[model samples]
Structures are given as structure tokens and as C-alpha cells.
Target chain A: MNKLPDALPVEKAAISDLARQTLHGTVDEATNARGRERMISAARAGASKSNGTQRRRRITRASVLLFAAAALAVSLVIWWPRAPLTFVTTGGEVTSTHDGGVRVATRDAESVTRFSDGSVVTFGVQSAGRLEGVRTNGARVVLTSGELHLDITHRKDTAWSIEAGPYVVRVTGTAFDVAWSPSEGAFVVAMRQGSVVVEGPLTPAGVSLRAGQHLVVARDGVMRMGEGTPPTLAELAVASSDAVALVSSAAPVVVSRAPSAPAEAPPSSSVPAIATSVAPSDRPASFAKLVAEGRYAQVVTAARGRGLEWVAESASLEELVALADAARYEKDGTLARAALEAERKRFATTQAGRNATFLLGRLAEDSDGNTARAIVLYDEYLQTGGPFSAEALGRKMLAVRKTRGDAGAEPIARAYLEKYPKGVYAAAARSIVGTP
Target chain B: MPLTVAARKVVPVVRWQTPAELVQALLAAEPEAHGVLWDRYSTSLRAVLRRSLGPDTEVEDALQEVFIRFFRALPTLREPAALGSFLFGIAVHVARGLLRKRRIRRWFRLTDDGEIPEPPDDVDPVSEQAQAAVRRLYVILDDLDDESRLVFVLRHIEGLEITELAACLKMSPATVKRRLARVTPLVFARARNDADLASFMAAPDQGERS
Candidate 1:
């Protein structure tokens, strides 16, 4: 068997996603109407071509045609069994238990498993999972405990699922990591690339984890998709064997660095994003330093291993902002959003929280592409009237234009220009308002 | 912009909620289905055009051609769920045809605008260098026979699986590979010499033969 080599430029590996954005921006109203017109003409031409055949078969019964179509469908389904996903390889201390579970334990070293579907799953030290069924459209595997990483090749329609106790992380094609421990009693999933839909018996509802997001769920039924990082091994194991006891009332604390460089911010301290759940004495500073150094992937991995349950309690709001900035540079929206959410929730009355709210509103509009949600968040954040007021107004108007009809959007466009005469979005506002 | 206030306030019109339902509507020759199709998949379909055809290729004309063909071929589509993939299949041929025509036009000394693009003022050296490398890559692609170049583009740029490529080109996977191999070295060896693109040849994928 032969395979094609990696022929694309490294940067162009994600060209398809970028191309989609390009198309969205480039396909104007004229192009859309033109394409639609062309399609209508082609369909009309097709119908005309088939008209003579229908006229010639005027005696044919509609009932006979319907019967033939149904019969063909039935025959095809009965004869064909969709191709099954088969295993390619596995590793770690594997044992087939009496309960019909293949227990895989990585005592010290990591174990790598590959599938014929071109998907790879790696288990970190002390981790374990059980082998499960691999069906045609997807596969089911149970993570008994500990950490595991997955790299899945993009598949059309088919989904691969990994079950960890009460939660299931389902993915079509993506790269991500998961950590679950019975003692810790939390199911954590981190997305590196692509997206996954996570739902479980204990979860309130299915929460989607886009690339750069993390989901944390405690055994006590407390779950949040964007509030904190993962818990550490020390928190899960050392302090107690009972995972439920480890559940902290306050969300996980994180100190994030701001953009433009952590050094620019005075005193170089990270802000307290979350309420101190685990209270790691020194980790927050080091974490902030990592973020400042633009080592976002490292920070995420560290949080997963140590359990994001801990952060320096003394971290300042400025430092938290920096940490979030670094996370954004790494394209980790979930982590960034989590930090911002914590800041908004914990320090609501402060200027820091106000800024966080504005940033969150922007993220909701730009990254999430939720125009309706953005409008609400922006409207609320604007009440704070902080440094980002001008920027926020421009973005809010853009969101408004998306939601409002062209005639209705005119007012918002006019309002935006009047507020900021030479604003960032002046040109855009002009186009929307049709101002000379 | 979203639907106007009046339209939203009006009795909520029943609409096709799923791809299957939309396909059914199109099959029935409902005119609204055309708008639905364009709104839903045009962005991705346009991307297919850019990847199959070059980025600079004037896709407005090609895009119109694709939509026309798409409507003509809708009745022949066996799987409604795979509408996106079906569009991709159509795009491969349309782009190939366009590429061939462009090559012929080039050969016949079609009037050239001679419009040269000026470099941006605030250029990132790394990005500029990469763009140049891509330009060189495509220039090499233009020199290859149409069949070989098409295979290379489909395999590399479009990221089509071998089986998918076979179905679209109406050729066996072996033949696709043979045609691809005819010009693979031209790109690989050239990239090997370019500092900016040399790493692409660092190590071939597992099962890939030189």
C-alpha cells in the first residue's frame, strides 16, 4: 500500500477552514443572486429535456415507478453491511477482564494506539481505558481512569466517541486530550484542533468544545464548559481518595497575562481569575510567566496534568488579563473565555471585570459567530462604559447589522458614526448607512 | 442582514429544516430550494473552487457554471447527506476544464493585462517568502501535463482521499498515483532546495513511496 506524502505547506494545512472565511467575505449579494439565477435557468433547461420523455410515457403509472424505487432501496440495505471500523494497534498493560473489558494500564511510560481509520490514541502514565465496540459510523471506548490524547483523521458523517464514567466526548474528526479519574471525580476534555460534542448522563446538556476550549465536570454534578482549566494529579490523588470531597465550591483560579507583553504591565502580577479552589502557592506565578513567554500549549498541558484546580490566590486582575491574552495567542478560546468568565464572576464590581465583560462580548460576536448572543452581551457590557467603549460600540453595531434588516440596521450604523466621528469602523459604518 | 422585522412578524413560513428535506424540495423543483442551497453550501463550495482552481482564478464565471451543473445533476444524486461531497465532485471537473481552457488561452497569446501587483508596505518577511515559494510551486504545476497537474492539485491542495479522487476523476487510484508521480519530484525536489519550503520534504508520510 502506498500513501501520498505531505505535500501542502505547513501553514496551508488548515487552508480549507481559511478558505471558508474567504468565501464568506467575498461572496457578495450580487454574486449570490447571479448564481441563483444561473441555477434556475439550468433547472428549467433540464425539465424541458425530460418533458418529451414524460409525454412519450403518458401511459406509465406513477404507482409502478414508486414500487420500483422502494424495492431497489430495500434490496440495497439488505445486501450491504456498512464497513466496520477495525483496530490497527494497541499498547500498555492490557488484560481481558471477566467483565468483558480490556483493561489497559500505563504504569509509567505512555502507550500509543493506532486504528485502521487513521486515528491515534495515546495513554499517559497511570492511565487506563477499556476496549469497546467499533462500529461502521463510529467507535465506543471507555476511559477507566487517567489521561489520554487523541488525534483523529477527518471523517465524513462518522463520529468517534470516548466514554469516561458519565460523560462521552464525541468527535467527527479532531485532536484533543482527556483526563478522568474516579478518585478525582472530574471529567476534563481539552480540544487541540477541530471540535467535539460532549454529552453525558450527568451533564446538564451537550456542550460543544470548539478548538482551544476545555470542559470540566465534577462528580457532584457541578459542570462548566468555560470557567477553569483541568485539575492536577496532586489534587486528585494526594489530598484524598474521595473525588467528591475534592470538589471546590469556588471555580478554579487562573492568573493570565495581558497582551502586548507581561513586562508592560506594572509589577508583573497575574490577576485572580477564579476563586481559589486548590490554592497552589507558587504555580500561578510560573503559569503567568509561561503565558507571558507565549507558551500557551505548555500552560494547558500543565493544567491538565496537575488539575487546573489550583492557582495563586494573590494574583492581581492585571496578571489574569495577561494570562488570557497569551491563551488567545495560542488560539485557545475556551481557556481564554474560562479565565474571562472567572474574572467577570469573581470581581464584578471592579474595572477588571468590566473589561473582561467587554472582551467576552467581542469573543461571542467574532469567534462564536453568535450574532444574537453578541448583541445581548455587548449591550450589557456597554453599561460598564470602560476603556473598550469605542471598540465595543463598533463591534456591537456590526453585530446589529447582522441581526437587523438593512433598513433597520441603518440607524445603528448612523449611531456608531455619530458617537465616534473617525472611529475604527467609520468606513464600515458609512457603507451600512450609505452616508456620502 | 437577517429577515426584516415584517418578515419575521409574518406567519412563520414552514421551511426545510434538514439537508434531506432541502434535497427533497430541490428534487420537487421548488425555487426556494435554490436559495437554500446557495446560502448553506456556497462558502464551502466556493472554497472547493479556489482549491481546485487557483486562488487568483476568476471563480465568478466558474461558480456560475458549477451551480448550473449542480442543479442539472441534483436528480442523479444518490445520497442527500453527501451533497457537499457531490458538489466537490462537480467542482473537480469544472476546475479542470477551466484550468485546461486557461492553459490554452495562455498558449494562444491571449491579451495580457500586464498588471503587476505591488508588494504590501508592511510585509512580514516570513509570509512574503512563503507566498513566493507558493508562486514558484504553482508555476511548476502549470508546466506539467494537464492530467498529472490535476492529480497533484487534487491530492495535495484539495486534500482528497485516493478513493475520493478516483471517483471524481473517473480514474483508478493506481492511475491517479501514476500521474501524480510523474510530477511529484518536480515539486518535491524544487521544494527541497528552497529554504522556506525545504521542511516539507523532511520525511515522507508512513507508507508513502518515493
Candidate 2:
């Protein structure tokens, strides 16, 4: 490996010179004049109150007042809200509550809590895990740890739900209760009112529960269905608070349960507490069956009906695509492409749609030589200014370069490189330039 | 008792002599503020700006603009300690914007023969010389696309950390890292060519200052 240099070369020096020149414009005398005029106007406004020789004194007083007011305003903006209170759990989950009722969700082991005013609190996890939600309600939080709980309640015309996770809980105007027990390696969903659908790779088939119904999906794909009792105060407390607080409160509850253990029999066999729901469309089993039986169109129909179209998480979409791909393995390309395209159209106005559009563009470019059309699509994606814009721009530049050759490509590449040198496609641009 | 009293009296003088206070005084439009600030930073600012902007442009005009913008924006500045970064940010923006416009103008002037006019011989060569030194230090920076070059300059030359550079350049740190990664090897290879550059590139060994 060769070493790097300590100084720049003449060409770079010239480029840097040009860079500097391009950056600094002559201070517009007019802009300066405007600034001066504003200042003078402000000063005049200050001086108009007092007459005669006292005008200078009044202007000085007014300036002081203005300075004081400005300082106060700045301080108010800076320190208006107290710093966010951060709660983090062992399994790479974090929650934050602000003075305002805004919540943030971050996963992939680290999460940040930003207040409505943009004050931030960052927390890290020692291990990989998921952070479900970081909810805020006037600085108080009910974080559910190592478990997922969904509580649905009906109030007048609205159905509300509160999803409790290890360090955060999200409340929406819907009803559902979900609990994940790491010990049992099972997830239980019990809807109190309205309807709740739980979707995940680990969710069991035929396990969609209605109000007063409960379903358990085990990690091993076991499906259990039974009548559910409304969550006890103790269970609610455990589900609503942090791990430390829950343990302390759960100790007494465990002690109390020990006395009743003798009288409790293994509940009746008729209820089938762990039996799979018999509904054809209810469970992960059903979805798996749909794929196994080559019912992709049915799966898509079911997914759309369940409002899964609105879900932005790529994992979910990937799961659906995988099912479709598996069911149509002999024609995987056609099915996957169709599924992805349909999903893209379904989500066109959504964040997910934007992502899908980028994916579609990549698929188009790589899978086919429709470079011209792909470039245009990529440009549209970039213009949307979504997270994928930089990537799209890079792809667009490459596509254009490949089709247009050096003379045609250089300007676009140069323009992109100039604007977004650190963009996702920078290496590609370099490759283009480096090519003989 | 006398010594204690004297020490107590000296505390106020020490307390009052802070950069923030001086800045505040300057904002108060005290004549002393200009002199004090100028004495403290004007020479360094001039050197950096002139070197960064090159000699062809009017350094005095740029310097005056920097100060004027600084003063106007001073009241809104939250952290006075970050004044260096703030000034640098302004300089980077001003310089980059100017350079971009110049490029556009020059691009339009390129004839059908693919010929572009050479810069005048009288062009101030100081910035050119500095840029040459920079290029010599990191040869890859010369060949890098404009965006990559700016990121490199902001990160390596300006010595901004990843996050700060990202914010300055309005880019993600991941993007910045990618750019840096792409340029790093080339820069290293170029730097290795020069002994002085090589010394700078060498990893600092623990307890081995020499």
C-alpha cells in the first residue's frame, strides 16, 4: 500500500481556489445597506419617543431594552422545555418522554428521544433488540420491558389502544392487548374491544382475536386460542411500568398466587387454551397455507383487507413478498415483481411507496437495460427528497453515464459530485471518472 | 487580611475578562469590542480566508463581509465558544457558492473547439499554492468528484469530526464515511510520497512522541 500526501498539488490548489471563489460572493452592497437601514430604522423607532437633547439618552435606553428583550427571547427559546427524560432497557430498547405529547420510535439497538423543541436524549443498548415505541405524556411513561402488551379500550365513539413495550408504549385510538413472554417463548394477543390483528414472522396462524378472545402464538409456531380475562391491575401494572418497578410489584403478586396454586386445576380441556383458531384466514398457519396452496392472490387480498397496505416496515412487505415468491417458485421473478409493483402502487403516496419506488428503479436498472426510463424514474425518486434520493441520484448518474458515454456523462456526474460528493453514488462516479 | 482583600478584588477583573463578555460588549457596539475582537482573531481569520479563498479574489472584501455577517448574526449565536466553527461554516458556504457560480460561468464560455481560457497570469497564486499543497498532501482529493472534494476538505482540511462535517455539508455521516473511505486510500498513497506528509500519516504510538 502506498502512503498519502501531506500537501495538495497545483491542480488541486487551483481547484480549491476555484472552490473558494465559487463559495464567496461579493458582499452585496445592497444587502449591507438593507441591514444598516433596518438597524437605523430600529434605532429611529427607539429615538422617536423622546425629544430635544434627551433623544440620544432615550435611544440608548431603548437599545438596552431591545438587547434585553432579544436576550430574553433567545433564552426562552433555548431553555423553554426541560431536557427529555430517557428510559432505556437492557435489551437495546429505549423510551423517552417530552414535556409535550410527542413520541419517537427508533430500533436497531439504539434509540434517540427528541423533544418537540428538538432537545435530544440518546440511549444505547448492549445487545441487539427492538425498540418498539418511545411515547411521551407530560414527562411520564409506562414502559413495558422484554414483553409486548397491547391494551384496547372503547370510549364513546372511539377505540383506543396502548402498546406497551420494555421502555416505551404507543397509544393509538384503537383497541388491542398483546403480550410477549420471553420465558414461555410465546406471544399473547387479547382484544378487549374492537378488533386487533397481530402480524409478524413469529405470529401463529388462526390467531386473530376479537374482543373477549385471546390467542397465543409461540416461538415454535404453536397456536393457542381461548377466552381471555380482562387484565388484572397487577398485570396492568407489570405491563405498564419499567422492569425494576415491575419486579418489585410482582414479588407480592407471585407470593399471593402461591397460595392459590393448590386449588387451581389444569384448566378444562374443552376450552383448548392452546388450540389454533379454526377460521380459514385467522392465523399465520393460514397465511402459510395460502402460500403452500399457491393462494398468493388470496394472501394479497387478505393482507389488503387487514389494512397491512399501510404498514411501512420493509420487513412486513418482504415477508409478504417471500410468501408470494415461495408459492410461485417456478415463476418467482414474475410473482415477486408483481407483488412489489402492486405494493408500490398501493403505497405510492406513502413513505413506503417512496422506498418501493427506489427499489423498483433499482430492479428496473439491474434486471433490465431500460436505462433511459430508469434514469427518469430515479430522477423522480430523487426529486421526492426521500431518504433514498441520494441513492437514486447515484443510480441515475450511473445509468446516464452508461448510456451516454464520457462526453455526455461528465457534466451530470460532475454536477452530482459537486452537490453531493459524499452521496451514496460517489464511488460509482469515481469509477466512471477513473475508467479509461 | 490585606492579601485576601486584594485577591477578592482581583476576582472581578478575571471574571469580567472572558470572550463571551467581550463579545457581548462588542454586540453592545462598544468601540472597544471591534478592537478587541480584531486583535484576537483578525490576523488568523485573514490568513485562513486568504489561503482558503486564494489570492485572485479580494481578501479585504471577503474579510469585511465575514465580519459584517458575523456581527449581524452574533445575537442569534447560541454558543459563543463555537464561534470558530460558525465562522468556518460561513467561509465554506461563501467560498463554495462563489466557486460553483464561477464554474457555471466558465462552462458557458467553453467554445465548440472544447477550449477553455486559461486563468490570467496575475491571478493571486497564494490560494493556488495552498491548494497545490493540499493536493500534494492528498492526491485523491484532486481527482475526487466535487462533492467528495468538498466533504474531504471539510473533514480532513477543516478538521471537522464526522457529525459536524455532516451537518455542515447537509449529509449523513454514513454518506460522509463512504466518501472518506473512497478517498482515504488514494490520499494515503499520495501522502506517502512525501516524507513530511508520511510523518503526519503515521499512527501515533503510545508514549512515543518522537
User: Which segments of candidate 1 are over 4 A away from where they belong?
Assistant: A5-436, B1-19, B111-130, B194-210
Please list the residue runs of candidate 2 whose C-alpha ends up more than 4 Å from where it truly belongs after superposition: A1-436, B1-17, B50-58, B110-146, B186-210
Model 2 Cα lDDT, one tens digit per residue, A241-277: 2232232322211100011111122223422221233
Best by DockQ: 1
Tens digits of per-residue lDDT for model 1 on A90-167? 567887746443567888888777777788878888998865666776666667688888998887766787877546
TM-score between candidate 2 and the true structure: 0.26
Enumerate the candidates' DockQ scores in order.
Answer: 0.07, 0.01
Candidate 1 lDDT (Cα, 0 to 1): 0.62
Worst 10 residues of 2 chain A by lDDT: A252-261
